[model samples]
Target: MTETQRKVGFLICLITIVLAVLDLQIVSAATVPIVRDLDPDHGVDKIPWLVSAFALASAAMLPLYGKLCDTLGAKRVFTGAIATFLLGSALCGAAQSMEQLIAARAVQGLGGGGLMSVTMVVIAHLKGPDEEGTGKGGSAGGLVAGAGMAVGPWIGGLLADHASWRWIFYVNLPIGLAVLAASAFVLKLPDHPVRRPLDYLGAALGAAFSSALLLVTDWGGNRYAWSSPVVVGLIVTAAAALALFLWRQTRAAEPILPLSLFRVRELRLGFVIQAIVGAAMMCAIYYVLVYLQIARGVASSSAGLYLLPMAIGMSTAGLLSGRLTARGWSARTFTLSGTATTALAFGLLALTTGPATSLWLIRAALLLMGLGLGQLMGQLILLVQFAAPRHQLGVATTGIRFFQTLGGALGASVFGSVLARLYAADGPGGDVSALARLTGTAHAEGVRAFVSATDVVFWSGAALMTLATVLAVRLPRPGRPEDTEQPARQPEPVPA
Candidate 1:
């Protein structure tokens, strides 16, 4: 690949990353408008499915997407993912009812699963033959992702308020078409000459397990009681599927996710730390928004703006980390320092946050949280890529993303349950939702209870980060002989 092709491919991948991250967040600001226009009477009750459909479908396809990348090559897989996503986007824009939109979103998610992970794989391949690691590519991707997370809701709000909610889905079409066209022309990825059989049964079982587990997490104690038959049955199903998937992996000709990757110290530690960081990030971003709305009396739209400070911090840290990486900073050094900084940030939030806590102080904590998170986000992927065997690069890259997403889902459920239980024990009502209806003394007491519960959540985040920091301490020193660099494979030419 020439330098011009590399630059164009990188740009396309970055745009795809932004689209993937933005779509996940943008719907939040338009839910009310969506319900009003689609099914004014019953759509409100079905709104959660809009988000769940996309996430469930996305998670279910991850392992398969990675396997396809390795077998069929990244160029073919990447373009196909984009085409599928754009088709879903068009269907979403044309949908006449909430159900149609939900189905369309699921279709979009099938493609969306590959957009981020496979793009990273492509970026890895974009490196010059003599170039080492991902260089600045990972950092650039992380910075864009952070910015997208920060601005997605605002952009959704602007579209929903000024024009139409449908524009949110429609907006992807032109940009996606441009990305698709550019990628087809510019991405020069190698095709695998040897076609490998995919582990269809293993992939199916893995998808079943992830789908069942996600449903359990999303519905437990929210949509159903913890003791409800639905949640219990789902949990059992997930466990059984997971067991079967693991059993199949040991025997499959080409497993979707190779269990042998776990043997590497860096890959093992990197996955664990990434998951914990993903969970902790939920506490920082989600709960902070919750606190602002309920306790500080800030509007939802205004509360989202608070994330801008964190985004700025992420950009700053990512920039610095990239430069330092070039200057000879090891991945282990970044992981250790990043985890420690994140733990301190969460601890500060736990210790100082209250109903009357200053916004400036909260912003400072968020900024610190971002600084730490920035270092870990990109570096962990690079770490896993470097440590993994050459043949399993695709699975290893996606595995980090898979664990982080799973952790975030589990964390949100657990933290939400904690907040509700604590609020029920101390506040006027068993339901925290009642706080919105409370006034005077009741509201004040509810706010106090809420703040106390949130502190516990932040403290739990601190403990998790502390554990990640300890794990980071055990990473093998850089330049170990075991860390063998894989030679670049020869390419099969892509057809125009």
Candidate 2:
């Protein structure tokens, strides 16, 4: 492919990624309005699923999507994913019930699972097999994703407040159609003619395990008590499924997730850090919006504006870290510092934020948090990519994403449960929206309760980040003699 084709292909992939990442943040901001409009009677109780279902479905499909990209060719799989997502978006926009909306979101996630991973694969194909190409492509991708995340909430809030909440989903139609057109006419990706047999059993086992695990998180204390038969059964099922999946990996000719990837110390440690980051980051983003809206009585659109500082911090730090890593800065240095900085930011948030706190102070904390997170986001991918063998690069990359998504799913469910329990105990028994909308003394009580509950949630986030900091310290330094040394002879390039 020529330089121009590569550029167009990269642009197309980047736009698709932006769309995928943006979907989560935008939907999160719009959740309040959506619930109010669709299920005002029991909307608060169902709010978590609006996010969790998408995350769960996306996590479940990730490993299989990676395998499919290799077997079906990136172009074919990517096109299909876009189509699936578009169909889901239309359904989401038209849905009149919470159950229908949640199911549609799952379909959207099934498509979204492919968008991020396949884009990375396609970018790799465009850049060929070179370290410089990997660094540049990875850096660009991270920046675009961060930017998308930063703006998504604001866009969602604006649409939800001024237009209809449905517009958040409806907005995807035109952008997706344009991507499809460009992908067909302008994007040129290499095709692999050889087909590998897919590990259907492994995929099934992996999906079962993830679904059961998410159910345990989602329903354990909310839908049923932790000791209830349903919760216990789900937990047992998840454990059993995990055991089977691991066992199958040992014998399958091509496992859906290659168990051997965990043998690499850097990749292994990097995944742990990535998972922690994913959990902490998701909690911070979504819960902060909750605090602003419920506790501080900020408008939804304005709540999104508050995230700008964090977004700026993340985008700036992410780009700088990527450039520095390419210039020989150690990944371990950024990992340790970034995780520590994030922990400190969360610590500040836990201690400082209250109903009476200044919005500017909260924004300042978010900015610091974003700076730390941005450094980790780009560097971790590079660390894993460098550590992975050439043949396993695609799987290794997708594996990092898989764990991260899983972490997000778990975090959202757990945090949502905590918030619900605390809020229920502190306020009158009803939806948080009703509590927030009360007048005079009742309004004050609602605000206090919301603030108190949010404080607990932020504390949990800080604790998670602190654990991530500890794990980040254990990561091996990048570019060490042992880390850099490779076989003198290069392997033949695999067909893309």
Candidate 3:
């Protein structure tokens, strides 16, 4: 591919990723409007499913998409995924009931799963074997995706308030169509479909495990007690399904996820670090929003506006780090430094949690946190890509994303449970929005109680990031001459 062609293709891929990630957060601000319009009577309980369904479906299909990319070629799979997403978007926008909306979201997520995984694989191919780090292209892609996440809620709120909540889904049509048109014309990768058996059984088991596990996290403390029979049953089912999946991988002709990838030290470490970072990042993003809306009594749109500082910090740092790494700076150094910086930022946030705390102070801490997160985001994938065998690139890339998604789900569940418990103990019986209406002394006490809960959350985040720092310290430095030149070896076939 020519330089110009590569640039165009990369941009198209980046746009797709941004859209996929944006859809995840955009609905948050629109939830209230959606409920009011759709199933107001029972919508509050069902609204969570709209988000949960998408997440669960996306996470479950990740491995399948990875394998599909390898078997059917990235172009075909990617284009199909985009079309499927567009279809889902149309359905979501036109849905008449909560159940219809949730089902549409699941369809949307199926396509979204491919959008992230296949694009990374395509980018890896574009970078070729000689590129040592996540090049400028990959870093730029990450930056755009992060920005989408940051702005999604603001956009959603704007639409919900001034226009219609349906616009949130409808908005994707034009952008997605353009992406498809551009990719069809600009992407020039050769497509040679492999005639091999896919691991159907393994894929089924993997999906089952992922879905069950996500359910356990999403429903554990929110809808049911942690020790409730349904939660415990889901946990057991997830464990059993995962065990069966792993055992089946050893016997399959073409396992959807190659277990051997875990044997690579760099890949293993990269997964671990990605999981920790994902958990910490999710917790920070979520609770910060909670603090803004519930404690500070800000509108959803304004809360999103406050997130801009962190988003800018992330984009700037990601671009700079990618450039430096490409120029031969050690990725390990950036990872370690970023991890430590994020931990420090979290500590600062814990200290500055009171309602009377300066908004500027909170913004500064969030900026630091985003900076730290950006440094690690693209670099970790670069490490994993560089270490993985060429044949397994799709699986390896998706594996990182898979673990990260799982971590995010787990973090949200655990942290939400903690906040609920603390809030109940401090001052019982009020919905999140109702707490914002407290007056005088009551308001002061409510804010204090919210701050106390946030303090614990941030402290926990700091500890997680500190652990990530230790793992980053163990990561091998980039720019090894031999490592860059090593040819892509044919990966071993799955056991028959």
Candidate 4:
């Protein structure tokens, strides 16, 4: 690829990130209409699954996607992934039942998961040349990549507001076509085909553990009450599956998630930090939506709009942190500082009374939290990649994301439940009639409950973030977010 084409290829991938990451938050704004259309009888309480299920799928499938990326070429896998995403989006638009919607979402999640992780690996491969303008350690490349992803929620909101919420998913169609076209002509990726075989056993075990664990978590409190037979059975089954997964991964020749990567202190610590960070962030967005639309009577579009500050705050923080890391600051500094800042931010947020409570205060709180989270992903990603042998970067990168995926799923589910619990008694005299008339009828009680419960959940998220800060301090700085050491041998084989 010529210089111009490389730039264009890079731009195409940026568009891919926008389409992919938007899957996570797109439902945040669209769930209202989705629930009305899919399960009018269930109301808002049960509708979170519409949003949370996709998150769970994307989270659960991240490693699956990563492992496949290693086995498959990035271009092949990327094209396939986007195709699946577009198919899922169309299916979601036509979904007629809750079951159908959930299944369609899983399909989207499968592709979304691939899009999330491969973009990084692909950028690494595409930007291998250290041309004069490519910048240090591909930092410019990484920055473009990360920044493209960070803006997903904001773009998602914009689409949901101006177009129908369904357009959020639909928009990916044209973009995916454009990416495919660009890749065919512009993107020049070095093929690194390794001799390692795909570890199907490992994939199956990982799937068992991830899917079952999340299923139990999602169904435990809501589907069957805590002690229901179904819940108990799921929990017991998940424990057994996870145990088997651990045992098999130890012996697999090419494990989907080689546990050996954790031997590196920085890598292991980074993985833990990623999980904690995911949990904290997952909860923050979940509760903030609650506070804005439910507790305070803000419009749906306005609620999505409020989160714009958070995206901006994180963008600024992400860029600054990358620059700071380049200047020789340690990961420990940014990670720990971010966590501390997040704690302060969330603590302040927990004190806010309502959406109208104070715009500046909310902005400040989100700003701090975003700043902390901004540098998080790219920084630790470098650590994990650095710790791995080149040939193993595929599995290793996926492994880090697996931990993050699991944490995010658990975080979102637990937080949603917490929000529900916090507002169980929210209605006036336990009567939702007026609220039913006031809010969307089918969603009246649930919406009110989530709103009333937002404060408590936000406080809980705040506490979780505080814990993340402590974990962040334990890892040594990996140096720069972009300056990762190459594996002794490259992970992708050189093209002939």
Candidate 5:
């Protein structure tokens, strides 16, 4: 692909990528009201299924869609995913009951899985090894994706509050249509030989395993005891199914997700780090929205407005880093510094349990955290691609997405459960069931204390980012700063 052609194709792909990410958090601000209105009598525990259902569907369908993209053309798969998103969004908007909404969300996730799974592959084709493989083009692709992820909450909140929660789904309709048209005209993705005889047994078993594990984790604390038969059953079923899935993959002629991608040290480590950091990035959105709505009594839209600062901070930092790398700064320098800063920000957030924390302090912490995170988020994938053989790029990218899904799913189950147990509310401040956990004045101060405990949750999330820092430090030193950090490096070779 020439420069002009590559720019148009990648830009169109970025729009679809943004829409996929937007769906992930666009529902966060609305979840509280959506569940309360739809299932008023149900326990808070049942609500995570709303989030997990979509996540579960997306997880199950990702490898399937990825394999299909390889078998069919990228355009066919990408367009189909967008259409699924639009249709599912309409169903969600028209849902009359919780069951209808959950079912619609599941449909939406089928398309979402495709969009999330395929963008990385689309990007790799755009940045071919024969062309400029790693540079501004590589880093910008992820930076744009990160920016999309950052804005989802703010946009979700604004739409849910200013209009109706249904608009969150409805908003995708026009955007998806626009992207389909642009991509048809501007994108120039090349063709690949189709793989036949996809591993049906492995796909089925993988989906079953993932769904069971997600359900067990999401509902264990709220709807059923963790030690109960239902949770235990799901756990055993998930383990058996997953084991079978893995065993079958090892022997299969054509695997949906090849087990061999783990052989590349940088790709494997990158995926693991992405999972840990991505979980923190995603779970923070979930909890912060809850904190603003439930603990702080802010409106759905108001929560979004406050969160906008983080988006601005992250974007500004991302663009600046891109510019810096363009000027010859080594990716390693930014990568290590960014990871360290993220760890530091989380530490500061952990100490913010008191009402006495200065607003300026909060904003500064968010800015520092965002700046550091943007660097890692933008640079890591380019490093992974550089480390992998060209033919395996699609599988390698999917591995990154899979780890991210695992981390987010794990964070949702564990973090959501812990938050529920800690904040059982007796007063008007929280869900009534949560209050029943407290006794007397201690109860009053206890919930108050726990309300301030959002910091602890934030801190736990920060620790995950700190882990990302460790892995980043272990990476083999960059071959050359120019090789992975700048667009100039792409069009021109850099000296070792």
Candidate 6:
């Protein structure tokens, strides 16, 4: 591919990633309008399904998408995924009822699964011979994602309030169509000559496990009690499916997620660190918003604006890290520094929690948190890609994303339960929103209690990030004697 073609391919892939991120963040802001227009009477009850359906279906398709990328080639898989996503988006825009819309979201998610993961594969392929793939494209992708996160909900709110709710989905069509067309013309992906039989049975089992585990996390202790039959049954199902999937992986001709990849220390550490960063991100974003909305009495839309500083921090770090990596800074150096920065941010957040704590202080901590995390996502994937065998690039890239998504789900569930328990022990029992409705003294007490609970949550996040820092210390530094094993294992080093 020529220079102009590479740039175009990169642009198309980034737009596709924006589509994926926007869809995830966009829906929440439009829900109230959707409920009113679709089924005001019964829609409220089914609202959770909107998020759940997309999340479950998307998670379920990830492993399969990775395999498809390697076999069919990234360009073919990329165009197909975009076409599927556009089809689903059209269906979503035209849906007349809540049920239909939810179903359409599930369809959209099937394609959405690849929008980010496979795009990373494509980006890695875009690198020219002699160009450093030290995460330049991945860092740019991260910056785009952070911008999308910062602006997505605000854009959704703007559209839903001023235009039709359907336009939210409709808006994706033009942009997505353009991306799809450009990719087909511009992306000249390397061909994979060696074809192997796909493990359909293993894929099915893996999908089943991912779906069940996501459901267990989403529904547990919120929609159903932890001990309820529904949650218990899902737990058993997830366990059985996971066990069977692992067994199948060991025996399959081409496993969906090969166990052999984990034997590489860099790949293993990269995966674990990616997961920890994902979970910590949930703590930073979700709990901060909760605190703002419930305790500080900030409106939801305005509360979202608070994330801008963090987003800026993320974008800046991504850009800066790309330059630093080019200057001989190893992935290990960034990992250690990033993890330590995030841990300190969390520790500061935990110590400063109070009903009257300044909002600016929290914002500062968030900015620090983002700076810390920004260095990890792209660089870690670069590390894993460098460590993994060339044949396994697709699975390895997607595997990082898979672990992160699971980590987010599990962390959200666990932290949510902890917050609930801690609050119930001190505050008047019920939703944290109740704190918003309380009057003077009671409201003051509620704020204090909520602050107290979030303090613990931040501390927990701090502890987790600290643990990641310790693990990062073990990562092999670039150009060092310890790093020789990784390059020795990947003799080809995955072509630029």
Please, what is the TM-score per model?
A: 0.96, 0.87, 0.94, 0.82, 0.85, 0.96
lDDT of 4 by residue, 1-496 (tens): 6767767766776677767666776676566666676678875775757766676677666666677767766777777878888889888877778788778888888788777677666665565434211222333333443344345555656765577666766777787877877787776665545545777776776776787777776777766787888878877877887888888779877677777666666667778877877777767765675566555676666665666567777777767776766666655676677777777777778777453567667767776667766766566666566556665666666676778877876887787676555555664423322344553544555554554566676777778777877776666444333433332233444646
**Candidate 2, 476: how far from true, in Å?**
3.1
Q: How many backbone clashes does candidate 5 have?
A: 6
Top candidate by lDDT: 1
Give lDDT: candidate 2, residue 43: 82
Pairs clashing within candidate 2? none
Per-model CA lDDT versus the true structure = 0.86, 0.80, 0.83, 0.66, 0.70, 0.85
Candidates by lDDT, descending order: 1, 6, 3, 2, 5, 4
* Clash number by candidate, in order: 0, 0, 0, 5, 6, 0
lDDT of 2 by residue, 352-433 (tens): 7898878889999999988988888777777777677655666777788888877876888788878878888887646465
Clashing pairs in 6: none
* Deviation (Å) of 469 in candidate 1: 0.8
Q: How many Å off is the CA of 465 in candidate 1?
A: 0.8
Please give, for residues 370-453, the per-residue lDDT of candidate 3 as tens digits: 898788777777778778886777788889988898888888888888887887789534534457677888777877887898
**Model 2 Cα RMSD, Å?**
3.6
Model 2 bad stretches (over 4 Å): 31-49, 94-100, 128-134, 416-456, 483-496
Angstrom error at residue 54, model 4: 2.9
Per-residue lDDT of 1-496 in model 1, one digit per residue for the tens? 7899999988999999999988888898899999999999999988989888888888888898889988999899899888988888899889999999999999998888888888888887887755555446877787677667767887888899999999999999999999998998898887887788999999999899989998998999999999999999999999999999999999998999988878777888889988898788877888988889998988987888888888888878877876787677876788888899999999989877898878899989989988888788778887887677767888988888888878888888899899989999998876789999999998999899999999999999999999999999988777665552332222333435
Error of 2 at 230 (Å): 2.2
- List the candidate 4 regions with Cα displacement exceeding 4 Å: 35-49, 94-100, 129-165, 193-195, 326-332, 354-356, 416-459, 477-496
